[model samples]
Target: MKILDKYILKTFVITFTSVFVILFFIFILQTVWLFISELAGKDLDFILVIKFLMFAMPRIIPLVLPLSVLLASIMSFGDFAENYEFAAMKSAGISLQRTMKFLTFFILILSLGAFIFANNVIPYAEFKFINFRKDIAQMKPAMAIAEGQFSDVGSYNIKVDKKSGENGNFLTGITIHKKSNNFDGSKNVIKAKNGELISNEKSNILKLVLNDGYYYEDIIPKKYEERNKIPFAKSSFKKYIIYIDLSKLNNTNNEDYTISNTNSMLNISELKYTIDSLENNRKKDIISFVDNSYQRTVTQGSLSSNKALNDSIITTKIKNPDLLSNFIPKEQSEILQIANNSIINTNYTIDSTEQELESKTKVINSHWIALYDKFVIAFACILMFFIGAPLGAIIRKGGLGLPIVFAVLIFIIYHFVNTFGKKIAQEDGLTPFLGCWMATFILTPIACLLTYRATNDIGFINMDVVLLPFQKLFKKIFPSQNQ
Candidate 1:
């Protein structure tokens, strides 16, 4: 290898490594802030906290690696240009493309490595991180009552408006859902104006003392016909005490804990399988719903009866426009009541089916987005390198000053577009493939333009290209006498 190639590779690698570490640390701090509630005041051991962060750190690589490439490329190349090293290389017959040969190959390897990490490492990390969080939440029964949001602890989902006092045992505006065998929904709901958590470390139970509370229990009817009545029991109490068993929760094994089914936890093959299964299930559901709706709304017997009635009416040549007038009052009323009930039931079914289908579709879209995201990470690294390397040469400014400004502005646009696309795709406004690649598609031309300008030794903006046509038009319109 030539001395020049060695020097260039060494400089770029050093800058890339430094930038990667700094950006990774910054993003890890952000991750800690995001999950602080799961850690803070939970009395978790230092080793557990470190494990939590370690499991979460892999997810940050996709975000950090590309940005590092962009900033590092710009800084390293811009420093060369600013120091007139590029001019010396050019005088010695080294072209910009020639200088980029080794670096391009390096970037290709980096991109491949990124793809491998995203496909394998990120999925594993996500699985561990999410399950670890679940285990941590139930590590202590008291940790389950996180303020402002629902926290699943054992069979009860607990939430509190505020928590105060040492150890945050004093709770305000508490709500709890006791999920028993009823997978249909939460059957028992407890709401309180205030509550207190009383626990003994030696015992396997936690005592919840409630003040000014209401208990609501929904009644399930044994008779199928009476199910629609929506019966329930509600009672208010000045003070209520409930015991929550902490034996299973305090056990850290989590053997009975249900694993989370988020898209982030699945690799490419798993995602494909899941997405296919979900789609097939959705199809089967739609077909079943349609058949059920048809049977409920219009049966074969009803259709035959309606046809007979229509034929009879046509043959009788009834002059009256009001069909109900022919029936007795009792029959008419009965028929109207039955019709109203069928309409109400059909409407309900339609609404519920629509919501279920929409939810399933969104879930499928999320899986597709996750699938495309792995490849996007690989492409983003290459895209950013091309943009940053050429941009540096064109601008000819080094250090953290101008390079930082350009990098931030460009990266902000990329991040914003990427986020917007994913949001739209999640809502089914756009296809997942397009949504995932939109930012790359939008910024690719900028990279090409920068590369071309830098290769030809043109400045940042080519004035000749911008003004040539305008100059010609001006001369033609003015009709210069000299011409």
Candidate 2:
């Protein structure tokens, strides 16, 4: 590298590294705050928390890199201008473009790094981080137990009174209450006097080894005449095994598997997959609705026939009261009334199913649209840079204060426009891709204009007129703005 090229490259690297480190710290702090909030009552080790953050860094780096590049380039170039380094180079016959050559190469290298991180590392990290969080949440009971507080591990609620012996590995005086309410209005509560949690690593089952406990069931009799309490007392066995449902923990594996199943981390491809899946689901739902509607039509027709039959029977009985008493018993009439009520209930159920299916279809469609929007937002980062860099040069104030303010204002405007477009797209049937890129498209021309004006020294907006009111008045009176 030439001496000047090396000098410029060093400045670029230093500035970019500083910005990246600052932004990475900021990302870490925000992530930690969110994680702390989420894991507030749960028990997680400090090492695991640190690991989670470390895994998250790769994902955050790609997002921070591009912005860091922009900031670094602008700062380095502005410093060169401020220090009269550019004038020195110009005097030596080096053009402005020549001065920027090294910086551009640096940017290209940074861009390539960002592409690798985004495509390869970030996706894997995201998948791992998510799974780690889920595992931590699932194993919270083992990690977050207090001496005298009730802790929920999966479906079972356990309380431990004392912890001692060998680094608190053994939990003494443990009480567990297992409640299952799956059946219609039936509850089973198992109370264990002394239980130790044993996790089988191979099978992933958390076994509650109960020393002495009783199972109590309050059964409502089928006759409806009496309620009975059935109790089973522990006698022979020292330990009773209550298996924790490992299926709940295994459910997250599907999401992990799905993430790992795909090789490419392209946002557009993911969006397309989501759209296709949603469309297929929608089609299935439509078919289900049609089948349900057909069934409901048949049921309604049957119910109408039943109603007519009952009406006919009542009319005939009313005409002959003596026959009603003799031919139809009082119990038979009551049974008929109950049967009619059941038919009415069946009609209500069909109506409810239809409504639920309609609601689900709408939700699925909304999800598909949302995925499409996210795909567009991912690409907008590249578009935003084209606008941000040129605007920075035109503004020409490279201190922390003005650059930050400018970046924030520009970002806010972009975010607001993008959000507005999404809302319109959702409500009306506006194009999803267009809605997402609207802000980028609108600002791109502005960026180009700023770049042209800065390069050519067109002075599109005179700063002196805005800063000094007298200059504006003088220009208006004299009719020669430049003079």
The candidate scoring highest on lDDT is 1
Which runs of model 1 end up more than 4 angstroms from their true locations?
A: 140-243, 246-257, 300-345, 467-483
> Residue-wise lDDT of candidate 1 within 329-448, one digit each (tens)?
764565576677777878898999999999999999999999999999999999999999999998899899999999989999999999999999989999999999999999999999
CA error at residue 36 for candidate 1, angstroms:
2.0
Which runs of model 2 end up more than 4 angstroms from their true locations?
A: 1-6, 37-47, 61-63, 87-116, 137-141, 144-150, 159-162, 167-169, 172-179, 182-195, 210-241, 247-274, 287-384, 415-430, 458-460, 463-483
Residue pairs of candidate 1 with colliding backbone atoms: none
TM-score result, candidate 2: 0.66
Predictions in order: lDDT: 0.87, 0.61
339: Cα error in model 1, Å: 5.8
